[model samples]
Target: MKTLLVDDHEIVRRGLKQLLLEAFPQAVFGEASRVPQARELIMQQEWQLVLLDINLPGGSGLDLLVEVRLLRPQAAVLMLSSYPEEEFAVRAFKLGAAGYLTKSSVADEMLAAVNKVLTGGKYVSVALAEKLAIALGNPQQQALHETLSSRELEVLRLVATGKTIKEIAAGFSLSEKTIATYRMRIAVKLGLSTNVELARYALQHHLVD
Candidate 1:
């Protein structure tokens, strides 16, 4: 099997490579540290699966996932992130990721998750599974933030975390005007008229830590 590991951190990529080598000795693995590098590698190779980090230096992993789905329809993508499962797991799945696993996940769990995805199965941590089940069982139990677009949700999250529009724009490498637009859209979607209200809603829903 061929696998690609995409992460910006050298230590993380190295550690994950070592773990995969131990678990699947016969698998061929490739690593990339940025979206452009990953994109180039993807075009040059046919990978069976991709282990992706949600945060990259120059681009969003979610954007990469969309491109990957189009370029390699047969390749399974497992999203690995430091963010909490409830924050982005559902959105990742909806965007065609095969699974979502947080960086805090145990080694055994991570191995099992990769194995499951290689076999065309989805994997989520036990705790996240329960959360998903409950959310599915009762639509009303779903977090309101889940209704926001990926961009809006991101803006809401940063806003709740006390980032100003300028900071958010710098963080995302976007224009201040674009960030402001996203903030406006988020407010409109959630029926919030002010950043304070948005922050309060995010806190109430646990969107911000």
Candidate 2:
């Protein structure tokens, strides 16, 4: 199998590559530090699996996953992110990722996750599996953040982190008006009227670090 590893950190890329090489000695591997580089590599070669990070330079790994699904329908993508699994795993799965693993996971678990995806299976940590099951069993108990669309959730996270609309617009390369519109929509969806309320809600729900 061929694999592509995408991450901004060189040390992480190197470590993951070495781990993958040890786990699947015959598997050909490639690496990229940003979405554009990864896109170039994808256009030039076919890969059986892609190990992606949620945070990437220039673009999000979620966006890359969408593009990969469109460009290479058969390639399985396993997301590797520092974000909490409960916060992003379901979204990633909905976006066509085959598996989701957090950065804090052990090396053995990482190897097992890669192997599971390679063999046409999905992977989630045991704790995450239990949490997912519980959430499925009780719809009313679901987190409010889960009700938000991916983009709205991203906006909420940024707001919770104390980013102003202008700063967020600059960070996302969007217009301030556009970000303000999103903020209003998010407030409506979450029953919040001000940034203070939004920040409080986010903190109460542990939505931000």
Candidate 3:
């Protein structure tokens, strides 16, 4: 079995390799820490499964998820994140991820999720499932932040976490002007003028750390 671990943290990749090795001793693994590297690997090879992290350096995991689904439709992508919000999980499912797992997941649960994904089944934690239930069961309960596009929402999260426009632009490989435009667009969409308000809104909505 060929599995790709796409996370920015080397330690996380190492730990996951070790954990997954217990169950998939014979598995061949590939690792990528950035979107470009991940995309190159995705285009060059076929993966049986991909454990993708949501907040990649160059782009969002959702972007790579879409590309991976297009390029390697047979591969199962299980998203990993520190954020356990239902919004993120729902977006991943909508973008064709096979599962969403938090970094705080227990080892057994992680293995189970990987097993289920490999077997062509989706894995959703009970916590997330319950949250999804609330969201799905009550469509009116959706937050205004849900209306933001993936890119805009990501920018907002970064801004909320105290990233300057230049820093965010650098990380995204986008022009400073473009990043500013995105920030402006987010303000217009969310109707929040100052960074403080944006930060408060993001925190209240659990969009940031």
Best by TM-score: 3
- Tens digit per residue, CA lDDT, model 1, 67-108: 899999999999999878987899999999999998889899
Alpha-carbon lDDT, every model: 0.87, 0.86, 0.91
How big is the positional error of residue 187 in model 2, measured in Å on the Cα after superposition?
1.3
lDDT by residue (tens digit), candidate 3, 26-48: 99999999999999999999999
- lDDT (Cα) of model 3: 0.91
Best by lDDT: 3
TM-score of 1: 0.83
Better of 1 and 3 by TM-score: 3
Model 1 residue runs over 4 Å out of place are 157-177, 193-209
* Residue 162 lDDT, candidate 2, scale 0-100: 92
- Prediction-by-prediction clash tally: 0, 0, 0
lDDT of 2: 0.86
**Stretches of candidate 2 exceeding 4 Å from the true structure:** 200-208
In candidate 3, which residue pairs get closer than 3 Å at backbone N, Cα or C atoms, i.e. clash? none
Arrange candidates, best TM-score first: 3, 2, 1
- Residue 102 local lDDT, model 1: 88
Is 1 or 3 the stronger prediction by lDDT?
3
